[model samples]
Structures are given as C-alpha cells and as structure tokens.
Target: MLVVSLIAFVMFRFIGDPVDQMVGLETTLEERAKLREQLGLNEPLPIQFWHFVSKAAQGNLGISYQFKQPVAKLIGERLPATLELSFVSALIALLAGIPMGVYTALRRESILSKLFLTISLIGISLPTFLIGILLIFIFAVILQWLPSFGRGQVVDLGWWSTGFLTVSGLKALILPSITLGLFQMTLIMRLVRSEMLEVLRTDYIKFARARGLKNRVVNFGHALKNTLVPVITITGLQLGSIIAFAIITETVFQWPGMGLLFLQAVQDVDIPIMSAYLLMIAFLFVAINLIVDMLYVVVDPRIRIGGGEA
Candidate 1:
C-alpha cells in the first residue's frame, strides 16, 4: 500500500503543479514561483514527497488546491456518501447475482439457464456509464418514477432514518447502483455457477445423491456450502470494485459522491484532492484483499488444515 501510494502521488506531481493551476495563467513566473514555494512544491521532488508522506502519516493529507480546506476534512465529509453508494450497490449486486447464479447452475441446460447466461454475458459486456444512462432513461425519463440527478434535501432526519432512502435520494441512487452492479453481477454469477457445478461433481455430493437425498438437500446443503467459499472470495474483491465503479457511476448519475469529487478534481487539476483520492482508493484495494484472504481461512476449513489427511 505504501508503494502504491507513493506511485500515485508521484504520478500526480508529474501530471502538473496544482499551485500553477490554482494561481491561473495571468500570474507571472515569479508569482508562480512564490506560490510553489509557499506550497513546498519548489523543493526537491523527493523532499517534497517525504514531507507529504510525513504529514500523511500524521493523518493530514494537506490542503486542497481547489477548496483551500484540509484534504482530510474534505474527504471526511464526502466519504460517507461514497461509502453509502458503494455499499448499497454491492448489496444490490449480491442480492441479484447469488440467486440468479444458483438457479442457473441448478438448471444448467434449460432455456431459462441459457437466458441467464446470455444476460450475464451482455451485462459483462456493457460499460458502466452506458448502463447508467440506459437506466436513467428508463426509470428517470420514461417512467418518471425517480429523479434523474442530485441527492435530496432530507438532511434533517437522523442518520439511521429513511432520509437517504427518501424519494429523491433513492431515485438518485437507482442508476448508479444498477450500473455498477450489472458487471459485478455477471462476474459473481459466472463464479457461482462454475463453483457449484464443480462442487456437485464431488464425492460427497455424489454420495448424497446416491443415498436418495432430495435434490434440494443435495444441491443446497452439500453443493452450495462448498460453493460458498469461492462466492465469498469474489464478493470481497467485488466490494472494492464496486467502490471504484461508484466513482464513475456516481459521476454519470450526477450523485454527490467521491467519484464526482474526483472527476471535478481531475478536470480542474486539483492535485491535493486527486492525490488524496488516489491514495484512499489504493488503501481500500489493499484492505479489501487482506479481508478476502482472512475470510478464506474462515470459510474453508480444508485450507486451514494445510491439506492434511483427515
């Protein structure tokens, strides 16, 4: 994670100086130099990097070039909305994908199974932004059932209340969540189907079937339990992907989340915010991978046994 963060920070600096961008073209070179000095950008690259790293270690991401606020404070304010969107989207993906996958694998050769496979393929094929647009057109325009953009003004309600799920907020989420979820749904469905099929061919599953156990019992009880290990692994990976995609999906939906903030930062050359966002994303990826690794031990006892004979 440290290496990744360093690379992202170096890349952002190489891209351009936020000091100059913030100061504008009308400023003289001397004035720009002063601004650079003020921001510590005029120091040697390695020294500047070290300074930023030290500050970051102290939980200070420095000041935002755009907002002139501390990056940490800005991130703190926006983090909740972004996390909310990503979490809700992941929930939508799991709810839709897991059942569809189990059903498809159970009926492998049927027409409904073939249809699901086709849908999964298409879902994986489409870009997230395109999916967001299609959803917005359908739900927000044609049906007029939901709002097309922006979070609602129901902020007075308590955090645990349904304020975020109010008419406007839910409408704003509809496009982004579905858009981000479709691709993840495809991946999970395929993983679940393959794992379930493999589990069904195992000795225990075969024995259960031969022992005259009901199809539901053999499939759901024996096969599904084994299949769950891989499902859990993929779900963990997708949680991070969901967060990354939420950036794009949120932008497409014009929802006020980290993705939208990152987009604005990139366009306006807000280096501090952009670098902070990049580092935050790298951290999330590393953290999620660690969690997935730990989950494997919990979900599959065979892994923890080191392949020992029972």
Candidate 2:
C-alpha cells in the first residue's frame, strides 16, 4: 500500500496543479499561494508524502480537489457498484467456465466440444471494450432487449445502495458483466481443461478406472477434484483482476463505479482521489491474495500436509 501510494502520489502530483483545477482564472497570486499552502502543495515532496501516509493510516484519506468531498466518502459511495459488477462477473465466469471446461475435457473428440473451444478462443481474443460495444449493438440497438448504459435504477439502503433488488438494475448488469467476464471465463476454461486432461492421465485416475469406478465418479469425484487446486489459484487472481481492470468496462458502460471515478480523477488531476484509489486497490489485492492462500488449505489437502511437515 505504501509503495502504491507513493507511486500514485509522485505520478499524479506533477500532472497538473490542483489549485488550477480548484480555483478559477480570476484568482490572484496571493490566493493561489494561500490555496497551495492550505493544500500543502507548497511543501517538500517527502513532507507531503509523510503527511499523506500518516493521515491514511488514521483512516483519513483527505478531501478530493475536484469533487471537494472527502476521499473516503466518494469511494464509499462508488465501491458498491464496482464490487457488485466484479462479483457478478466473477460468478458468471466461474459458473460457465468450469462446466464448459469439464465437458470439453471429457468430450474432446465431440463436435460440440470443438464448438465450445472455438467460442472460448473468440472470447479470449476479443478486447473488453469491443465486446461491450458488440453486446450493446446486438442487444440494445438492434434487438432493443437491454439498455445500453447506466445503472438503470438503484435503491439506497441507509449508507449503501444496490441494484439487485430492482428488475431494471438486474437487466442493466448483463452486458457489462458478460464483457468483463468473457476473457476470464475463457482463461479459466482453458486452464481447467488442460489440468483435467493432465489429471486424467495420472496413475491415481487410472487406478480408479481400473477399480471399476463409474465414469462420473472417477471423472468428477477424483479427476475434477485434483484439477481444482490450480483452478482455485487462477480464479482468485482473476477475481482481483476483475475489480482492478473494471475501469475499461465501466468507462464503456458509464457504470458509475470506482473505475469511472478514477478516470474522472485522472482527467481532472484529482490527486486525492487517485491516491486513495491506488491505496484501496493495493489493499484489495493483498486481502484477496491472503484469502486465496487460506482457500488453498480448504481446497487441497496436499498443501495442508506440506505446511504441517515444514
């Protein structure tokens, strides 16, 4: 988080003067100087960074230069949208990818399996923005089946708001979720198929088959179980990537998520927002990785045994 914060600070600090964005052209030199002093932009880089770090540690992310609101407040307002989109995308990827992978692995010679592979290849090859645009063209423009952009309708519940309870909100999520998830789904599918094939060739799988185990039991209970260790790792990392990289999809869809907020900050040179976003994303990556590490023990007994021995 410190490294990310420093990088964000250095990178954004020099992009433009925050005072220039904060103040109008008619502002005098004395006013600009006072504003700089108030914002601490006149301080040395090290001192500024120290103040940033210290305040961040105390749960104060500072106020946004552009929005003139608290950084934490801005993020808190937008976080739910991003998390909702990311989790829905991740769920779509895992739900579709894993079954497709298993089927392709088990029915490699079938024409249907070949078709799925072809579709997976297309999913992997398409860029996210292009995919989103295509979906919009098909579903929104041509078919008039779904809305092209916006969150549609959001229901506020105290401090948090959500779209899931509303029908239009659920409809609004479909395109962006699919666009964001397609690449990840293809990746997970390919990984699972490859791992399943490898696992099937192992001695344990052959032993289970030789023991007259049913095909479903041997394939799913044994082969699929063993393939999941790598799958879990990739899925966990991809979930983090979904959140971090949702910027493109959010921009394309105008989804009002943190990514969209970050883009606005970049354009406006809102250093506080940019810095807070960097630190938040870094913290999320760390937290997701820690959870993934814990999940390894739950998914794979070998990891637990190795840890016990060491």
Candidate 3:
C-alpha cells in the first residue's frame, strides 16, 4: 500500500502543476510562481509527498484544488453513498447468483441451463458503463419506470442512513445496483457451478447418493456446503473489487459517490483529491485482502493448521 501510495503521489509530478490548470493563460509566470508558492508547490517533490503522507496519517487528505475544502471531509461525505451502493450490489449478486448456480449445476445439460449460462457469459462480457446505459434506456427513457440518474431523496434512518434512503431513493437505486452487480453475479454463478460440479463427483457426494439420501439433501447439504469455501474466497475478493471499481458505474448513474468526486477532480485537474483517491483505493484493496486472508483460517481450519496465513 505504501509503495502504491508513493507511486500515486509521484505521478502528479509528471502531470505538471495543477495551478497551471486553474490559472488563466493571461496570468504571468510571476503570478503563477506566487500562486505556486502559496500552494507550497515550490517545495521539492519528495518533501511535498512527505507532507501529504504525514497529513494523511492524521486523516487529512489536504485541500481539494477544485472544491477548496479538505479532501478527507469531501470523501467522508461521499463514502456512505458508495458503501451503500456496493453493499446493495453485492447482496444482489449473491442472492441471484448462488441459487441459479446451484440449480443449473445440478442440471447442466438442460436447454434452460444453457440459456442461463449464455446470459451469464454476456453479463461477464459487457462493459459496466454500457450495461448502465442500456438499463437507463430501457427503464428510464423508454419504459419510464425508474429515474435515470442521481441518488434520489434521503430518508432519515437515524444513525443508519447515508441520507439516501426513501421511497424515491430506493426507486433510483435499482438500475445502478443491477448494473454494478451483473458482472459479479455472472462470475459468482460460474464459480459456483464449476465448484458444485467438481464437488458432486467427489467420493463423499457419491457415497451420499449411494446411501439413498434425497437429491436435495445430497446437493444442498453435502455438495453446496463443500463448494462454498472456494466460492466464499472469490466472493470476498470480488466484493473488494466491487467497492473499489464502482467509479465507472457511479459516473454513469451520476451517483454522488467517491467515483463521481474522482471524475470531477480529474476534469478540474484537482491533483490533491485525485492523489488522495488513488491512495485510498489502493489502501482499501490491501486492507480487504488482509481481511479475506484472515477469513481463510476461520472458514477452513485446515488452512490455519497448514500455516497458510503467512
């Protein structure tokens, strides 16, 4: 994470001063120099980066060049929306994927199974933005069933709300959640199908079948339970990816999340916010991976016994 943060910070040096972006062409070099000095741009790159790192340790991500507010504060305000979106999307993926996967895994050679798998393939193949646009066209523009953009009105949920929960808010959330979850849903379906197929062929599954256990018991009880360990591993990693990679979906839906903030920062050449976002994203990935690694021990004690955590 530190290495990635350092890289993110260093990349800005190559982009030149963001003050160049903010100042007018009529501005003199002397004026630019003064502005740079005011923004502490005259300092050595390493020194500036160290200062950023130091402030970041204290949850200060510096000031946004565009918003003119502290970057951390801005991110804090936007984060709950992103979290809500990611959480809802992952829930959709899991609920939709697992059952479909188990059902199809138990009947892989059927026509309906083939059709379902084909759709999952297409789901995995399409770009997320394209999916979002298609959804908007179908549900928002043509059908006029759901709103096309934004996070909608906030419902007061006391301590549990991001201020984005209401009848209108729930209505607006549908398309973006489906758009974000489709890829994960398809991926999870395939993983579950593959794992289930392999598990069904195992000796325990064969013995269960031979023992005259019901199909439901053998599939749901024995095979599904065994398949879950690997599926969980993928789900954990994919959930992390979903949170970090929601940037494109947020932009398509115009959702007021970190991704939208990053887009705005990019358009305005807001290097401080951009750099902070980059670092924050990398840190989340690292933190999620660590948590998932620890979960391996809890999920399957054999890993712990084998010293797999190192």
Candidate 4:
C-alpha cells in the first residue's frame, strides 16, 4: 500500500497543475508563483511527498480545490452513498450467484447448465458502462419502469440516512446496482462452479456419498462448506474492484458517490483530492484482504493449522 501511494503521488503531481484548472490563463506571473507556493506545489517532489505522508499520518489529507474543503471531509460526505451502492450490489450478486452456481455445478452436462454457462460468459464479456446504457435504454427509455440517472431524492433519517429505501430511491438504485454487480455475479458463479466441482471430487465428498447420505447433505453440507474458501477470497477481492468500476458506473448514471467525485477530480486536476482518493482505496484494499485472511481461520479450522482441508 505504501508503494501504491507513492505511485499515485508521483503520477498525479506531474500530470498537470491544479492552479491551471482553478485560475485563468491571464493571471499575472507573480500571482501564479504565489499560488503554487501556497499549495506547496513549488516544493521538490521528495519534500512534497514527505509533507504529504507526514500530514496524512496526522489525519490531514490536504484541501480540495474543487470543494474548498479538507479531502477527508469531502470523502466522508460521499462515502455513505458509495457504501450503499456496494452493499446492495454485492447482496444481489451473492444471493443470485451462489444458488445458480450450485445448481449448474451439480448438473454440468445438462442443457440448462450449458445455457447458464453461456450467459455467464456473455455477462463477463460485457463492460459495466455498456450494461448501464442497455439497462437505461430498456427500463428508462422504452418501458419507463425506472429512472435512468441520478441518486434520487435524499431521505432524511437523522444521523445517517439514505434515499435508497424510498419508492423513488428504489427505482433509481435498480439500474446502477445491476450495472455494477453483473460482472461480480458472473464471476462468483464461475468460481463457485469450479470450486464445487473440485470439492465433489475429493475423498470426503465421495465418502459421504458412499455412506448413503442424502444428495443435499453430500453436496451442500460437505462439498459446499469446503468450497466457500475460494468463494470468499474472490468475493473479497471482487468487492475492491467494485469501487474501481463504480467510477464508470457512477459516471454513466450520475450517482453522487466517491467514483463520481473521483471522476470530477480527475477532470479538473484536483491533485489533493485525487491523492487522497487513491490512498484511501489502497488502504481499503489492504484492510479488506487482511479481513479475508482472518476469516479463513473461522471458516476452515484446518487452514489455521497449515493444512488446506477442513
């Protein structure tokens, strides 16, 4: 994560000046120099990086030229929306993908299984932006079933509130969540099928079958339990990618989340905000992977003892 932050720091500082985006081209030379010094852009790269890391360690992520607020404050304001989208989307994927994967794995040679595999392949092939557009064309343009864009009306509920549960909000969420989660659903489906097949071939699974266990017990009780490790790993990693994809997804739908903020920040060369965003995401990925590693001990005790089987 430190290395990733370094890369983002070096890449962003060299791309363009935040001053250029904020100020007019006709500004006096002295004023431009003063502004550069004010933002610490006139410092050497190494010195700038040092200050950045030092300030960040102290919980100061610098200011955003776009919003004229601390980068942390802007991110905090937008984070709930992004979290809401990710939760809904991941819920849809896991609920739909797990069962679909189990059934298809159990009937790999059947026609229905083949059809599902083909559909999964197509879904994995399509990008989120294209999927968002198609959904909008169908639901927003043709059928008129849901809104095509925006985060809908803000629902106030005191400390922490989201508009997603309201009627209008639900309509607004449908397309973006589907758009964001389609790839994850297909990915989880494929991972589950592969893991289930491997588990069913193991000695324990075969022994359960030979012992006259019910088919459901042999499959779900033994095989599925064993198959969850990889599913959890991939799902954890895929959840990180969801944040990255949300940039494109939010841009397509105009949802007011971190992704949209990042997009706008990028366009306007908001270096402070961009650096904070990149660093935050890098930290999130590290934290999520650490959680996944810890979950392995709980899910499969054998893994805790250095054996692959539990």
Can you write out model 4's per-residue Cα lDDT over 1-310, one digit (the tens) per residue?
A: 7787787778668877778877887999899999989988878989998888888877688998878899988887777778788878988889888988998999989998898888889789998899999999999999999999987876866645586668888778889999999889999999999999999999999899999999989999999999999999999898887876788889999998999999889887887888888888888788889999999988988778885453
Worst 10 residues of 1 by lDDT: 154-163
Candidate 3 C-alpha lDDT tens digits along 1-310: 7787787677666676688777778999899889888877789988988876787888888788777899998887787888899989999999999988997999988988898899999999999999999999999999999999998886545433453547788888899989999999999999999999999999999999999999999999999988988988898889888987899999999998888999898888888888888888887777777887888778777888896565
Q: How badly does each model clash, as a count of residue pairs?
A: 0, 0, 0, 0
lDDT of 1 by residue, 1-310 (tens): 6786698678768887576568777889898888878888777888878888888878799888889899888887677778877887788888888888899988988899899999999999988888888888988889988777776543544332232656766666666777888899888888888898888888999899999999989888888888988798789888987887788788887877788888888887887888888888888888999988888898788788877877
Pull out the clashing pairs in model 4. Answer: none
Best by lDDT: 2
Residue pairs clashing in model 3 are: none
Q: Candidate 4 versus the native: TM-score?
A: 0.92
lDDT of each: 0.81, 0.92, 0.87, 0.86
Which residue runs does candidate 3 get wrong by more than 4 Å?
25-34, 156-164, 307-310
Estimate the overall C-alpha local distance difference test score of candidate 1: 0.81
* Ranking of predictions according to lDDT: 2, 3, 4, 1
Which should have the higher TM-score, number 1 or number 4?
Answer: 4
The residue-by-residue lDDT of candidate 2 on 1-310, one tens digit each, is 6788888778657877778888999999999999889888888899988998899888789999878899999999999999999999999999999999999999999998899899999999989999999999999999999999988899999878898999999999999999999999999999999999999999999999999999999999999999999999899899989999999999999999999999999888888898899999998888899999999999888777987766
RMSD of 1: 2.6
